[model samples]
Target chain A: AQSVTQPDARVTVSEGASLQLRCKYSYSATPYLFWYVQYPRQGLQLLLKYYSGDPVVQGVNSFEAEFSKSNSSFHLQKASVHWSDSAVYFCALSMTNSAGNKLTFGIGTRVLVRP
Target chain B: AQTIHQWPVAEIKAVGSPLSLGCTIKGKSSPNLYWYWQATGGTLQQLFYSITVGQVESVVQLNLSASRPKDDQFILSTEKLLLSHSGFYLCAWAGDSGNTLYFGEGSRLIVV
Candidate 1:
């Protein structure tokens, strides 16, 4: 079984400040990693995903995440944040298989970007 | 472009009431359909997924049932509603690659 853990439950950052969300995964082999953002009362939007290739992957709205196989972690980062960036971000893991591509998600980190 | 729509944007039902939710995918044929449940202030749990019509697979049973009636339609239902079922229900679809999933706006359920 695979699982994801997000260490931060909530984070508060001022506008124009850098932000980072931590995520750790437990999987025997390399797993597909993703970052998704959910706005208030809205469905989740895919931020970025990583399988192999480059260690760092860029996503929509200037978001990016790095996959570290050695540490079994995939952390999301942004150079700067805006008030509109306030939302709940989730880290998810999916293994390549034939069985419907099920995803296991982390508890999510609620980010509050202050103006 | 592919689009997924979930019906009954929001619904309020009493406990023990029968409930049904619908999802339809447009511009995509034979896409993998999925149902996910999210509790208030919590992560998402995949309830069911269907690769083709009449072949639905359960991921985590929440006393709910799902069915793919058509190539583009997926339905989630339960005979009786529970307070635990009060949350957000998201409908998603994956293309042939099946690497990434696209989600719908979601429906909010409030069970009293």
Candidate 2:
């Protein structure tokens, strides 16, 4: 079974500060990695995804994630985060061979940007 | 542009009451539909998926059932709601088996 782990349960940062959210996955095959953001009372929206090629994938709102095969990590990074960036971030992984193509997601990390 | 919509944006029903949530996808045809449940701060758990109308697969059963009556409509319902069902329910549509899922705004349920 594929699983995802997000170490940080909560992260606090000041506005304009750089941010990094750690994510690790365990899968038998090369999994499809994704980063999703959920605002308060809203469903999650995709931030970025990596299928093949290009270790770094850029997403909406200047979000980017780097996929490392050896480390089994796909960490989301932002050069400068704004106050509006405060939300819950989830890292998900999907295996191609799985039934229903279900996505295993991390517990999520709540980001709070202090203005 | 494709859009997904879920009905009853927020609901507060007494425990043991019946429940039903609906999702509709527009600007797309014959898309794969899915139902997912999320606890207060937990990861999402897929409940069901439908490849076509009238055919649904249960990924994980939580005493709930899902039906895809139309090519673009999915419904999640239960005869009796439980206190454990108090959380968020999201509807998603995937282009393929399960690639990128476009999610609806979601429906929040509170079984008090």
Candidate 3:
């Protein structure tokens, strides 16, 4: 079974400061990775996804993620965060062979941007 | 553009009461539909998925059942609601690539 682990449960960063959320996955083979953001009482929105080549993938709102096959990790990064960036970010994994492309998500990291 | 909508926005019901939730997808046909459950401040767990109408597969047993009677509709229901079932229910559709999933606004349930 594929599982995602987000080490940080909560993160507090000052506005305009950089932020990084760590994510690690456990899978026998490389799986499709994704980053999603959820605001309060709202559904998740895809931030970005990693498929094949290019270790670094860019996403919306100046967000980016680096896929490291050797480390089994895909970490999300933002050089400067706005107060609106505060939300719960989830790291998800989807196996190519899984039925329906079921996604296994991390517990999510709640980000609070201090204004 | 494709859009997914989940009904009733939010609901509150007593324990052991019957419950039903509906989802509709517009502008897309024969799209894969999925039902996901999320506990308060927890990760999402896939409950059921349907590749086409009249065929539904259960990924986990949460005392719940899902069905797809129409090509663009998916339903989730249970005979008796449990307090543990109180959470956010999300309806999603897989993109053509089958790699990305687009989620609806979600339905929130509170079982007292």
Encode model 2's per-residue lDDT on B12-92: one tens digit a residue.
999899999999999888888889999988889999999899999999979999999999999999999999998999999
Report clash pairs, candidate 2.
none
Clashes (N, CA, C under 3 Å) per candidate: 0, 0, 0
Residue-level lDDT of model 1, residues A28-61, one tens digit each, is 8899899999999999999999999999999999
TM-score of each: 0.98, 0.98, 0.99
DockQ of each: 0.90, 0.76, 0.94
lDDT of 2: 0.92
Model 2, A57-96: lDDT tens per residue? 9999999999999999999999999999999999999887
The candidates score, on chain A by TM-score, as follows 0.98, 0.98, 0.98
Best by TM-score: 3
Query: Could you give the DockQ of candidate 3?
Result: 0.94
Q: List the residue pairs that clash in candidate 3.
A: none
Model 3 spans with C-alpha error above 4 angstroms: none
Count backbone clashes in candidate 2: 0
Query: Which residue pairs overlap in candidate 1's backbone?
Result: none
What is the number of residue pairs that collide in model 1?
Answer: 0
TM-score of 1: 0.98
lDDT of all the models against the reference?
0.95, 0.92, 0.96
